[model samples]
Target: MATTHADDPGRCPEPLSTPDDFMGGFCAFNFTSGPAAGSFCWDRQPDYSAYRESSFGHGILEVKNETYALWKWHRNQDLYQGAVGDEIYIVREPERCLLKSSIAAYF
Candidate 1:
């Protein structure tokens, strides 16, 4: 899950209580049953990694030399949405990818 820093503080999840801005609630859920002829919990956590915002410093995720997939969806013609938006082949050298302890040295 990817998260960003919040502008201001928020009422943290108090004990077992719900968070002031519960990100989980935004995700839709269902109740599937064999007797009913449907499925439940179709869209659950970790399935669609959520990018939530929290009251903390922000930092971007650094993905290097990785195989990633980008996808899109349509209400009607959803079949083709799974097609790759762009095929990316990343090649990052370890030496160039690493950051120096003395950042000013580069300058």
Candidate 2:
């Protein structure tokens, strides 16, 4: 899922939330029977004054066994050329990363 908001500070008082915010809603997709599905999320807020607004971008995710999937984004300004933004790849594996638990819960 994707959402684009204007860069006007008055319009959006809070910082943008990450994709994790939608995780609960995504569980339904995971349970559906079908070819394994992947999820993609994006946010775009362009400064009206600067012509150098966020442009198109693409992503490629490799789910293993050499299989790959790709996604792309194009800014309205580059409608003719179809310019793309930075590319990304997602590699899945059993790994551990530093995680923090809520401190408020312990109080």
Candidate 3:
């Protein structure tokens, strides 16, 4: 689950045992706003080689080479929204993604 940085300063999972190895788990993040506002968790059931975010309304995930896209469902408006190259970070070891004040232009 996602939480404030002051609540849980999570650590990245341990490295895979081998290059071809697979590890399964999850990581909580403290993102600023939006669907991932609080108590957010990312699935790492296969591997941490990629980043992903999903919710009832939308999903943003990495496809390859650190590229990501957003898919949203505007059910009431009967429209689907999508975009590529959304901002995200894949934190590992000695690094962290922290929350800050939201910027109006980002909307």
The local distance difference test score of each candidate is: 0.34, 0.37, 0.35
For residue 105, model 1's alpha carbon misses the true position, in angstroms, by 7.0
Ranking by lDDT: 2, 3, 1
Q: What local lDDT score does residue 71 receive in model 3, on the 0 to 100 scale?
A: 37
Angstrom error of the Cα, residue 102, model 2: value is 25
How well does candidate 1 match the true structure in TM-score terms? Answer: 0.21
State candidate 3's TM-score.
Answer: 0.18
Q: Please, what is the TM-score per model?
A: 0.21, 0.24, 0.18
lDDT (10s digit) by residue, model 3, range 1-107? 34232222353332332232232343335556543355343322334333423332333544444333333332222234443323555434222223433432332
Off by over 4 Å in 2: 1-71, 95-107
Cα-based RMSD of candidate 3: 15.3
Who wins the lDDT comparison? Answer: 2
Question: Which residue pairs come into collision in candidate 1?
Answer: 32-39, 32-40
* Ranking of predictions according to TM-score: 2, 1, 3
Residue pairs in collision within model 2 = 56-73, 56-85, 57-85
Q: Write the per-residue lDDT of candidate 2 for residues 1-107, one digit (tens) a residue.
A: 34344333343322233234456522222313222223221123323434433333333443445434344554554555756644445443323322443332321
- Which is the better candidate, 1 or 3, if ranked by TM-score? 1
TM-score winner among the candidates? 2
